[model samples]
Target: MTLGFTALVTAIVGEVAGTMSLRKATTGSKAWFVAVAGSYVFAFSMLSVSLAQGLPLGLAYGIWAAAGVALTAILSKVLFEEPLTPVMGAGIALIVGGVLLIQVGSAY
Candidate 1:
């Protein structure tokens, strides 16, 4: 994959990790707060590099938001026992579809 894509994926992972840490810190323990700060730093750094790599704003943002939303939804369901109704699933699908369309459109 492209470097931009790689960076975006890294940012997504970092953001998710940071969010998980925040949740843990809130409902589990105090030590996890450190993770929240560190992970967010990592997340923002990755996103900055991705933009510096000349990735189009639309492509970078679309992919980032889509992946973040999808992964967060899954994580919430798994970690917090949150609901994942069919409607939610469809919304996720739509996000993915919109991201794909943006990718295709921007390629041309």
Candidate 2:
């Protein structure tokens, strides 16, 4: 895969990990803070790589935001037993649709 693609994937992973760690940290655990910091470090490095790889800033940012929001919502529901109402689900679907449109535009 291209560097930009790799960076994007890495960024997503880091973001997910970071968010999870933060939730864990809320339980008064110092170790989880380490996880939080590490995840952010990895995320920032990957974002820098994505930008340096010449991916359009708007495209890269849009994908990052969309992926982060969707992943966080899904994971929160799964990991924390957070209830997902119909309205929230529909909003997520719309965000996913918008992400698809952005990607299609980038491909051309």
Candidate 3:
């Protein structure tokens, strides 16, 4: 895979990890704060790398944000007993669809 795509993937993973760690930190674990901070920094750094490598801002950010929201919601439901209602699932689907549209539009 291209470096830009790889960096974007890393950014998505880092953002998701950071979000998950934030939940732990808020639940009274100070150590998790470190993970949260580090993860966010890494995520943004990778995102910048992707942009520098010629990924359009709109497409890259759209995919990253949509993936982050979807992944975080699913992971939270599994790890923290968070609710994953059908309505929320539908919202996620819409977000993914929108991002896909943005990606396709960017091609033309």
Q: Which candidate's TM-score is highest?
A: 3
Cα lDDT tens digits, model 2, 1-108, are: 898989988998898899988998997687899999999899988988999999887788878888888888889999998878889989988987897788788778
Mind giving the per-residue lDDT tens digits that candidate 1 earns over 1-108?
A: 889779989999999899888888999889999999999999989998899998887888888888888888899999899898999999999999999998888768
What candidate 1 gets wrong by more than 4 Å, as runs, is: none
lDDT per residue as tens, model 3, 1-108: 789989999999999999999999999779999999999999999999999999999999999999999999999999999999999999999999999999888888
Cα-based lDDT at residue 89, candidate 2: 87
Per model, state how many residue pairs clash: 0, 0, 0
How close is every model to the real structure, measured as TM-score? 0.89, 0.87, 0.96
Model 1 deviation from native, Cα RMSD in Å: 1.4
Query: What RMSD, rounded to one decimal, does every model reach?
Result: 1.4, 1.8, 0.8
Candidate 2 residues lying further than 4 Å off, grouped into runs, are 103-108
TM-score of 1: 0.89
Instruction: Give the poorly placed runs of model 3, Cα more than 4 Å off.
Output: none
- In model 2, which residue pairs have backbone atoms overlapping below 3 Å? none
**Candidate 1, residue 26: lDDT:** 96
Output the better candidate (1/3) by lDDT: 3
The local distance difference test score of each candidate is 0.90, 0.87, 0.96
